[model samples]
Target chain A: GEEVAQTPKHLVRGEGQKAKLYCAPIKGHSYVFWYQQVLKNEFKFLISFQNENVFDETGMPKERFSAKCLPNSPCSLEIQATKLEDSAVYFCASSQSTYGYTFGSGTRLTVV
Target chain B: LAKTTQPISMDSYEGQEVNITCSHNNIATNDYITWYQQFPSQGPRFIIQGYKTKVTNEVASLFIPADRKSSTLSLPRVSLSDTAVYYCLVGASTGGFKTIFGAGTRLFVKA
Candidate 1:
C-alpha cells in the first residue's frame, strides 16, 4: 500500500494491564521505526527495525517495553504492566535508504 | 546525531513570508538538514531537506550557508493552514537511523 498503516486508532488499558500496538509499513520500505509522543510534543524514539531484525533500541525503556518486526506480519510494540506515564500517542514510520520517513496516523494509548 | 535549537513560538499574519531558522553548531560532515511540519494530532510531515546552499520544493525553500552551522526554512505567503510545529533535524541520511528531535518551533499563523 502507499501509506503506513497503524491499527486500533485508540486503546485504553488499566495501569497493570498490557497494551500492544501494531504497524504495517509501506510495501516496499525496508525499515520501520516506532516513536512515542508525550504531551502532544516531544517525540521519543522507541526502536527501529531493519527487515524483521532489531536495528536500534537505545531509546526504549529497558524493563517493560518490547518490540518486534517479524516477516509476513505487522510490527508490534508491547508494553507490560503499563504505568500512568505510559499514556501517550505511539507513532510508526517507514523509510527506505533515504532521508525521509512516511509516518502513520498513530495510535493513542491511554493507561488508566 | 546533531542537536538543533529553534524558537519556542512565533506569530504571523496570513499571506506573510515566514522564515524559521535553526542552529546545529555541531553538525557533522555527513549530516543533512531536514524540516518537518506537524499539525495537532498528526504525525510530522517532511517538508524540505538540504545538505548545503539551497533547496526549493513546491511547498517551501531551504537555505543553508557554507558553514553548514545554520539553515532557514522559508514559507512564501503562509496561510492559517501553515500554522503548526516546525521541526529541524540534522543527521546522517543513512536512512532508518534513530532520529533525535528537539522542541519544535510553534508557528501560529493568524488572519
Candidate 2:
C-alpha cells in the first residue's frame, strides 16, 4: 500500500486492562517506527523495527510497553497494564531512505 | 542525532507569506533537514526536505545555507487552512535510524 495503515482509530481501556495497537507500514519500507504524542505535543519515540527484528527500543518503557513486527502481519504495540498517564495518540511511520517519512493516522488510546 | 530549535509559536494573517526557521548547530554531514506539518488531530505529514541550497515543491520550499546549520520553510501566501504545527527534524532516516522530532513551531494563521 502507498500509505501506512493503522487500525483501531480509537480505543478506551480500563486502568488495568491491556491495550494493543496495530500498524501496517507501506510496502517495501523496511523500517517501522512508533511514537506517542501527549497533549497535542511532545512526540516521544517508542520503538522501531527493521523487518521482523527489533531495531531501537531505548525510548520504550521497560515495564509495561512492548512491541513486535512479525512477517506477513501488521506491527503491534501492546500495553500490559494501562495507566491513566498512558492516554495519548500513538502514531506509526514508515521510512525507506533519507528522504522522509509517511505517517499513518494514529490510534487514540484513552485509559480511564 | 542532531537536535533542532525552532520558535515556540508564530502568528500570521491570511494571504501572508510565512517563513519558519530552524537552527541545528550540531548538524552532521550526513544529516538532512526535513519539515513536517501536523494539524490538530492528524499525524505529521512530510512537507519538504533538503540537504543544501534550495528545494522547492508544490507545498513548500526548503532553503539551506552552505553551513547547513540552519534551514527555513517558506510557505507562500498561507491561508487559514494552512495554520498548523510545523516541525523541524534533523537526522538520517535511513539504515534503521529513527527520525526524532523536536518541539515544533505552532503557526497560527488568522483572517
Candidate 3:
C-alpha cells in the first residue's frame, strides 16, 4: 500500500527533444511530489500537488518544465526541448497527512 | 523550509550502531525533522521522522533535543547492505509542506 509506481524506468532522448515521465501515487494518498537528482547529488524538489491542485511549484524551471496531476489519471512530468543538463533521475513520491513519503523507483532520463 | 547540515560521509563496520546527526538551527515551531535513505540508482526511502524528543520504529530511531536545533538518526546493528546515503529534511505542514533535501551523509559500511 505504501508504493508509488513510476513508469519508463529508463528514457533516452536527444537534445531538444521532448520527454515525458509518469507516476501513480499510492491509493488514498492526496499529496504527490516530484524530484530531480543529478550526478548522485542532492534531490531537487520540482513540484508538488495536493489532490490534483498545484501546491508548490517554486522549483520547476518555467522555461520548459511542466507537470500535471489530473483526476483518475497518473501524474506526469513533461520537459520540452530537453537539454543535456536535464539528464537525471526523476523520482515521484506520495504521502498522506502526517505520514512519511513513499517514493517510486524513479525514471532515469539520459539526454544525449 | 529549514536548511539542514550533515556530515559528508561516514564509515562503519558490521554489528556497530551508527549515528548520523543533522543540524537545523532555524527550525520553525511546526517543522518536523525527517530522514531518508537512498541507494544507488533508486529512489529515497523514508527512514524515520520526529518533531521533538525521540521516536523509534522497527528500522531506525530519531532523536531530537529540546532546542529543536538538531536531530540524530540512529541505526541499530549495521550491515553491509545498510550502506547508503542518508538525507535530512525539515519542513512544515502549515505552508505547502514542501520537503527540501540536503547533501546528505553517505555511510559506507564495511564488512
Candidate 4:
C-alpha cells in the first residue's frame, strides 16, 4: 500500500507571517488534492492537481492561499499573511483510481 | 456532483456490529459512493466504495441497493479504535477526480 507523505507534522506562525506546507503524493498517483479541516471538523476542498496542471481550485481562497504541484517536485501549499482563523489541519491526498484515495498524515497549522 | 446525507453521530459498544447509512438522492448514473474514516489530527482513510449491489473487502462492506440512491457501510465486530469520523462522498469518474466531503458522521465506540 502506498502512502502520501506530508512534512512538518506541526506548524506555528504569527499573524501576518507566511506559512508553507509540503506534500509528497504516492509514487504512481497522478492526482493530488489538498483539503483544509477547520475547527468545525469539516473537510474543505482547497485545490487539486492532475499531473502538473491545476484540475480544480474552486475551494481555494484566492486572496491569501496558493498551491502548486510541479514535475519532479513535491506539492506545496503556502499561506500569506496568516490569520488566527487559518489554524487547522491540512491534508494531502493522492489517487490513481477514481475511488481509491490515499491520504497523508497531515500538517497541523496553528496561527497565533 | 451528488450531495450525500448521513447521521451526525452514532454510538456503539465494542464487539458490536455497526452499520452507517448515507443517502444520495441526486446520485448521477456515473457516480460512485465512497466512504472514508478520519481520526483526530489525521487524514481521512479510505474504507470502501461501490457503484451498485454489494462490495466487500477486508476492512468493511458497502451495500448499494437497486435504486442507488443510498448506501450502507457495515463494520463487523467494531473495536474501540474504530471511533472516528466517517465521511461519505459521491462523484463520477469520467473526468479528473474531484470529491466533495460532507459533514462526516462521528462514531464513538464504547468499551
Quick one: best TM-score, which candidate? Answer: 1
Give one digit per residue, the lDDT tens place, for model 1 in A1-112: 8899998899999999999999999997889999999983788999999899988899899799999999999999999999999999999999986657888999999999
List per-prediction Cα lDDT, in the order shown: 0.92, 0.92, 0.92, 0.90
lDDT tens digits, residue span B44-110, model 4: 8989888999999998999999999999999999999999999999986434557888898999999
Q: Candidate 3 DockQ category?
A: medium
lDDT value for candidate 3? 0.92
Instruction: For candidate 4, give the lDDT of residue B47.
Output: 92
Using DockQ as the yardstick, the better of models 1 and 3 is: 1
Q: Which ten residues in a row have the lowest lDDT in candidate 4 chain B?
A: B92-101
Q: What is the lDDT of residue B57 in candidate 3?
A: 97
The residue-level lDDT of candidate 4 at B27 comes to 93
What would the per-residue lDDT of candidate 2 be over residues A19-107, giving only the tens digit for each residue? 99999999999999999999748898898899999999988997999999999999999999999999999999998877788999999
**Whole-structure CA lDDT of model 2:** 0.92
Candidate 3 chain B least-lDDT 10 residues = B92-101
User: Candidate 3, residues A39-100: lDDT per residue as tens digits?
Assistant: 74768999999989999999999899999999999999999999999999999999886757
Give the clashing pairs for model 1.
Answer: none
Cα lDDT tens digits for candidate 1, B1-111: 789999999999999999999999999998889899998878888898899999999999999999999999999999999999999988866556887887999999999
Q: Point out the worst 10-residue segment of candidate 3 chain A by lDDT.
A: A93-102
In model 1, the runs with Cα more than 4 Å from the true position are none
DockQ in order: 0.72, 0.68, 0.59, 0.61
